[model samples]
Target: MTHTILGANGTIATELIPVLKKHNVNIRLVSRTPQHVEGTESITADALDSEQLLSAILGSDVVYLTIGLVYNAKIWEEQWPVIMRNVINACKTTGAKLVFFDNIYMYGKVDGIITEETPYNYISKKGKVRAELAKMLLKEMASGNIEATIARAADFFGPRATEKSIPSVLVFEKLKAGSTAQWLINPNVPRSLNYTPDIAEALYILATNEKAFGQVWHLPTPAPLTGKEFVKLAAKHLKSSDKISVLPKWLLKIIGLLNPFMKEAYEMNYQNEFPLHLSSAKFEKAFAFKPTSYEDAVKETALWHLNR
Candidate 1:
C-alpha cells in the first residue's frame, strides 16, 4: 500500500522513507521541488495547495505529516494554518489515515515530568498553534470523518540534522572541531532527546497498527542527560573529555537583538537551562519497546560525526 510522506527532505523523513521502503511500503514523497529518490515515488506539491495535497494523498493508505513552518516565525504563522487546512480537507476527502510527526513545544514548561497526558500549558504562539492543530485533528476523528494518530518526539537529533536545532550546530559541529561544546547549560537536569530513526519506527508502527489510530503516542526516548553530561559522553566516545560550556545568557540576548531566530531561542532556555524531562512509559508498554541506551546512542552519534 502507498504511504505519502510530507517534507520529503526532512531529517526524520530521510530515515523514515528508507525504513518504509524496507517494509514494502510504496513510499511517495511530497515536496515543493521533489527529486525522485531511487526506489521511491515523488510528487512536487505544496501542502497549501488543496488540489495538490488531494492529488498527493489520493489512494494512500497512510500519510505522514512531517511538514512544518521551519525557521521563520512570521511565515510560520501565515503558512501553517493553510497547510493544515489542506491536509485536513484531503484526509477528510480521501479517508487516508494521517500519522503526524510532532514535537514537544506544545507541552511547554513542566516542573516535574512531561507525560502524554500533560496539558497544553504554554502561552507561546508556536505552542498554541501546535495545540490547536492537534485538537482539531482529534476533534475531526471524533466525528468519524478521519482516522489519525500522532507520534510525539522530543528535540530531534541525528545524522543530517543541520543548523536549525540543538544537536546540529550546537552539538555535532562543536564536538567535531574539538571545542568545548556550547549549549544553554543546565547540568543536573534531565530531558529526553529522541533519535530520528526511533521516532520513524514509532511512526511506522502507528501507520500499520490499526489499534493505534485516534490517539497520540510518545516515541521511545532515552532518559535525559544534562547538557554537560551529554557532551562529555559524546566526547568520551571520541577519546576526548572536554568540559561543556554555555553561551552566556547575556550573549544570547545580545545576539537576539539582531537575529529574530535567536530571539525565539532565548525563550526556550527551559529545555537546556533547567530541569525538563519527557516520559515515554506509554509507548514502551504499548509496543514492548525500549529506547537505545543514552551511552550507546551518544556513541553512535559521535561516530557519525567523526565519520563525516
Candidate 2:
C-alpha cells in the first residue's frame, strides 16, 4: 500500500510519517515546497490544483489531508471548499481513501462533552465554513464517491508545533525565554487538547480500519487541563517561572481590528470563554489506544521547544 500525505511538512503530518513508515507502506510526501527524505518520495504541488493533486495521489491507497492553511478567516473561506473539492475529486478518480485531520470548529459552543454525535451549530464565520466543508465531504461519502473518515481534535500541541498554535506561542516559547506567559480568554477554564503524536497515530489507525470510514472520530486525549495548569505544568518541567497572565477577549478584539490573524481569532474566543472538552470513547472502543498523559506530553513539548 502506498500512502500519499498531503501537506507533508505540517505538524501532524511530520509525526504521522514515521507511524505510516512503521506499517511498511510506500510513502509519498507532498507539499508546495517538498523536500526529499530518506524513506519517502517527495512531490511539489499546489493541493488546490486538481491536476497536481491527482498526479500526486494516483496509485496510492490512502491520501491524508493534513494541510494547514494560513491563519486568516478570509483565506479559509475562499480556499477550504476549493481544496476539499479537489481532494475529493482526486480521491474518487484514483480510488484512494481520504483521512481528514479536522478541528472542532463546526460544533461551535457545546453544552457538555463533545462526542461524535455533536451537532453543527455554526457560530463564527470560520465555524460555518468548517461545517459546510465537512457536510460536503459527508455527502460525498454517503454517495459512495470516496472512502473517507474525519478525525476531529481539539487545539493541538506537540513536537515542531509552530508559533501559530496557541500552546507553542503562549506557553512553550515563553517558558523557553523565561518570559511571563499569556493566554487568551479565561486561563482557568478546563479545555481539551490532543498531543500531536496521538492525533497522528489515531489518523493512521483510522485510515487503516475499514469500519472507520464514512464517520467522524474524536481522537483520544488525556484529561482536560486549564490554561494555567497547562503552563504551570510546563514551567515545572522546565524549571521556569510559572507566572502567567490572561489576555482579555476585548483586547484581542481590539487588536484584531488591525491584525488579520487576531481578528479571526477574536471570533473563536468563545472556545476559551467556556470549557469545551472533546470525548473520545468511540475511538477508544474502536482502537483501544489511549493518548499520552499531560505530564509526559508537556515534558516532551518543553524539551522540543528548548531544542528548537
Candidate 3:
C-alpha cells in the first residue's frame, strides 16, 4: 500500500512518517518544499493548486491531509476551503481513501465534554473555516463520492510540536529554559491535550482499518488536567520551578494589538477560560488504544526540549 502525506514535515506528519515506515508501506511525502526522507518519495506541490495536488496524490492507496496554514483568520478564510476542496477532489480522482487530521476548534465553547457527536457552533473565524471544511468533507462522504475519515485531536504536545503546541511553548519550553512558565486565561479549568506520538499511531490505525472509514474519530487522549497541574508536572520533570504566570484576557488583548499571532489567538481564548475536555471513548473502545498519561508525556516533552 502506498501512503501519501499531503503536508509533510509538520509535527504530526513528522511523527507519523516513522509509524508508516514500521508497517512497511510505500511512503510519499508532499509539500511546497518537502524534506527528503530516506526510503520515501518526496514531491514538492502546493496544496492550493488543484493540478499540483492531484498530481502528487496520484497512485496512492491512502492520503493524509495534515497541512497547517499560517495562524491568521484572513489566511484561513481564504486558503482552507480551497485546500480542502483540492484534496477532496484529488482523493476522488485517485480512488484513494483520505484521513483528515483535524482540530476541535469547530466545537467552540462546549459546555460539556467534546465528542464526535458534538454540534458545530464555532465562534472564531478560524473555527468557522474548520467547520466549513468539515462540512464539505462530510457532504462528500454522505454522497458516497469518496471514502474518508476525520481524526480530530485536542491541542497536542509532544516531541517536535514545540512550534505549534501552546503548552509546549508556555510550559515545557519555558521550564526548560529556566524562565517563568505561562498559562492563558484561567489556570483552574481542565484542558485536554493529546500526545503527538499517540495521534500519529491513531492516524495510522485509522488509515489501515477499512472499517474506520466514513466516520469522524477523536484520537485517544488522556483525562484533562488543569493548567496549574500541567505546569507543576512539567516543572517537576524538568527539575525547575513550578511558578506560573497566567496571561489574563486583557493582557492578551493588549499583546494582540502588536503581535499578529496573539491577535489571531485572542478569539480562541475561550478555550482556556472554559473546561476543554475531549472524549475519545469511541476510538479507544474501537481500537483498544490507551493514551499516554500527562505525567509521562510531560517528562518526555521536557527531556526533548532540554536535550535540544
Candidate 4:
C-alpha cells in the first residue's frame, strides 16, 4: 500500500505519519518545502499545480488532502476552489483514491448536535467555500471519476498542533506561564474539539476501507467542553491556577485593527457564540472505536506544551 499526504507538515499529517508507517504503508509526504520524516519519502510540490500534484501522487494508492490556507476569507474564496480542483484533477489523472480532511464549518450554526445529515444552511465566506469544495468532491465520486471519502474533525488540540488551534496558542501558552488564559466569545458555551492523533487515525481507517468511499464520516470525538472547562482541565494537569478570561467582541475588534489574523477571526466568531457540538455516533457505531477521553487529551497536550 502507498499513501501520499499533501500537507505533510500539518498537524494531522504529522500525527498520521507514524500510523501509516506502522502499517508498513509506503509514504510520500509532499509539501512546498519538504522535510524528511523517518521511513517516508519527502517530495517538494505545490498542491495547486495539477502537474506537480499528479507527479507526487503517481504511484500512490491513496492521496490525502491535508493542506490548509491562511485564515483569511478572501484568500479562502480565491484559493480553495482552485486548490480543490487541482487536487481532484490530479487524482483523476493518477487514478488514486482521495481522503479529504474536512471541518464542520459548512454546517454553520445548528440547533442541535451536528450530524452528517445536517443541512447546509449557514452562510459565511469560509462556510460557503467548504460546502462548495465538499460538494465538488462528492460530485466527482458520484460520477465514478474518483473514489473518495471525507473525514470531518472539529477544533483540534494535541501534540504539534501549535499554529492555529486554541488549546495551544490561547489556553496552554498562558496558563503554563501562570498568566490568565484568553478565549473568544462565550467561554461558557461548550464547543467540540478533536485530538489530533484521533483525527489522523480516523482518516487512516477511512482511507483503507472500501465502504467508506463516497461518504462523509465525523471522526470520533468526546463530548464538547467550554473554554472555562477546558482551561480548568489543563490547569489541573499542569498544577496551575485555572484563571481564564473571555475576550469581548469590542476588544477583539480593537486588537484586529492592527492584526490581520485577528481581524479575519471576527467573521468566524459565531461558532464560539453558540454550542457547536459534533456527533460521531455513526463512526463509532461502524468502527467500534471511541475517541480519546477529554481529560487524557488535555493532560497529553499540557505535557507537550510544558516540554516545549
Candidate 5:
C-alpha cells in the first residue's frame, strides 16, 4: 500500500511520517522544498501546481492533508482557499482517501465542555474558513468520489512544534532560561494539550481504519490544567525555573502594537484567556486508547527542550 501526505514539513507531518512508514514501506510526501524523509519517497511540489499535485495523487491509496497556515487573517483567507480548491480538484481526478489533520477552531464559543457533536458557528474569520473547508471535504466525500476523515487535535506540544503552539513561546522557552515568564490570558482556566507523537499515532489509526471515513474524530488527549499549574510543573521539571507571571491583557495589547502575530493570538485569548474544557470521549471509546498522563507528557517535553 502506498500513502502520500501533503504539507510534509509541518509539525504533525514530521511526526506522522514515521508512524505511516511503520504501516507501509511505500510512502510518499509532498512539500514545496526538498528534504530527505527516511522510509518514504519525496515529491517537491506546490498545491498550485495542478499537474504536480495530480501526479502525486495518482496511485496513492491514502493522502494525509496536513496543510498549515499562519495566524494572519488576510494570508490565511487567501492561501487556504486556493490550497483547498487544488486539493479538491486533484482528488476528484484520482480516487483516493483523504485524512485531514484539524484543530477545534470552528466551535465559536464553548459553553462548559467541547465534544465532537459541537456545532460550528464561529464568528472569527479563521474559524469560518475551517468550518467551510470541512463542509466542502465532506460534501465531496458524500458524493462518492473521495473518501474522507478528520482527526482534530488540541494545542500541540512536541518535537519540531516550536514556533507554533503557545507552550513553545511561553513556557518551554522561558523556563529554559530561568526567566519570570508572563503567560497570556487567565492562568487558572482548563485547557487540553496534546503530545505530538500521540497525535501522529491517532492519525495513523484513522488513515488506516476504513470505518473512520466520513466521521470527525477527536484525537484522545489528557485532562487539561490551569495555565498556572501547567507552567509551574514545567518550571519544576526544568530545575532553574522562576514562578510564572501572567501578562496582563493591557500589556499584551501594548506588545501587540509592535507584533502582528501576537495581536492575532490575543484575539483568540478567549480560550486559555478564560474557562473552557475539551472532551475526547468519543475517540477514546472508539479507539480503546487513552492519552498519556499529563505528568509524563510534561516530563518528556522538558527533556526534549533541554536536549535541543
Candidate 6:
C-alpha cells in the first residue's frame, strides 16, 4: 500500500513516518520543501495549487492531510477553504482515502467533555474557519464523494512538538530554563492534551482500518489535569519549581499589540478559562486502544527536553 503524507516535517508527520515504515508500506512525503527520508519518496508541491496537490496525491491508496497554515486569522480565513477544497478534489480524482488530522477548536467552549457528536458552536475566528472546513469535508463524505475519516485531537504535547505544544511552551520550556511556569487564565480548570506519539499511532490505525472511514474519531487522550496539576506534574518530572504565573486576558491583550502569535492567541484564550475536556470513548472502544498515562507522558517529554 502506498500512503502519502501532505505537509511533511510537521510534528505528527515526523513521528508517523516511523510507524508507517514499521508496517513496510510505501510512503510519500509531500511539501514545498520536503526532506528526503530513507525508504520514502519525496514530492515538492504546494497544497494551495490545485495541479500540484493533485499530482502529489496521484497513485496513492491513502492521503493524510496534516497541513497547518499560518497562525494568523486572516491567513486562515483566506487559505484554509482553498486548501481543503484542493485536497478533497485531489482525493476524489485519485480514488484515495483521506485521513484528516484536526483539532478541537470547532467545538468551541463546550460545557462538558467534547465528543465526536459535539455541535459546531465556534466562538473565535479560527474556530469558525475550522468549522467551515470540517463541514465542507463532511458534506463530501455524506455525498459519497470521498472515503475519509476525521481524527481530532486536543492541544498536543510530546517530543518534537516543543515549538507548537502550548504546555511545552508555557510549562516545560519555562521550567527547564529555571523560570516560573505560566498558565493561561485559570490554573484550576481541567485541560486535556494528546501525546503526539499516541496521535501518530492512532492515525496509522485509522488509515489502515477499512471500517474507520466516513466518520469522525477523537484520537485517544488520557484524562485531563488542571493547569496547576499539569504544571506540578511536569515540575515533579523535571525536578523544578512548580510556581506558575497565570496570563490574564487583559495582559494578553496588551501583549498582543506587539506580538503576532500573541495577537492570534488572545482570542482563543477562552479555552483555558473553563474546563476543556475531550472524550475519546468512541475511538477507544472501537479500537481497544489505551492512551499513555499523564505521569509517563510528562516524564518522557521532560527527559526529551533535557537530552536535547
The segments of candidate 1 whose C-alpha lies over 4 angstroms from its true place after superposition are none
RMSD of 2: 1.2
Candidate 4 stretches with Cα past 4 Å from truth are none
Error of 1 at 3 (Å): 0.9
TM-score to native of every candidate shown = 0.95, 0.97, 0.98, 0.97, 0.95, 0.98
Q: Number of backbone collisions per candidate, in order?
A: 0, 0, 0, 0, 0, 0
Candidate 2 Cα misplacement greater than 4 A, ranges: none
Ranking by lDDT: 3, 6, 2, 4, 5, 1
Off by over 4 Å in 6: none
Candidate 6 local lDDT, 1-308, one digit each (tens): 99999999888999899999999999999999999999999999999999999999999999999998889999999999999999999999999999999998898989988899999999999999999999999999999999999999988999878788889999999999999999999999888999999999999999999889999999989989899998998999889999999999899999999999999988788788999999999999999999998999899999998888
Rank the models by TM-score, top first: 3, 6, 4, 2, 1, 5
On residues 119-174, what C-alpha lDDT tens digit does candidate 3 reach at each position?
99999988999999999999999999999999999889998887799998998888
lDDT over C-alpha atoms for residue 87 of model 4: 90
Candidate 5, residues 1-308, lDDT tens digits: the string is 88888988888888888887777548888988847876678888888677888887888888888978667978877887778778878877787778889888888778778888899977687788888888888787788777788789878887667888678778888888767756776887888888898898988888888888988998878888878788877887888564778888888888899999878867676776766677878888888988877788888888888999
Worst 10 residues of 5 by lDDT: 267-276
Query: Each candidate: what lDDT?
Result: 0.81, 0.90, 0.94, 0.89, 0.81, 0.93
lDDT of 1 by residue, 81-166 (tens): 78878998898899889988887878888888788899888656777777877887878878887889878987877766665447
Candidate 6 TM-score, C-alpha based: 0.98
Q: lDDT tens digits, residues 232-263, model 4?
A: 89999888888888888888899999999988
Candidate 2 lDDT over residue span 82-180, tens digit each: 999999999999999999989989999998988999899979988998999999999999998899999999898988887647898888888788898
**lDDT for position 47 in model 6:** 93
- Please give the TM-score that candidate 2 achieves against the real structure: 0.97
Per-residue error at 165 for model 4, in Å? 1.1
Model 4 residue 239 CA deviation (Å) reads 0.9
The lDDT, on a scale of 0 to 1, for candidate 5 is 0.81
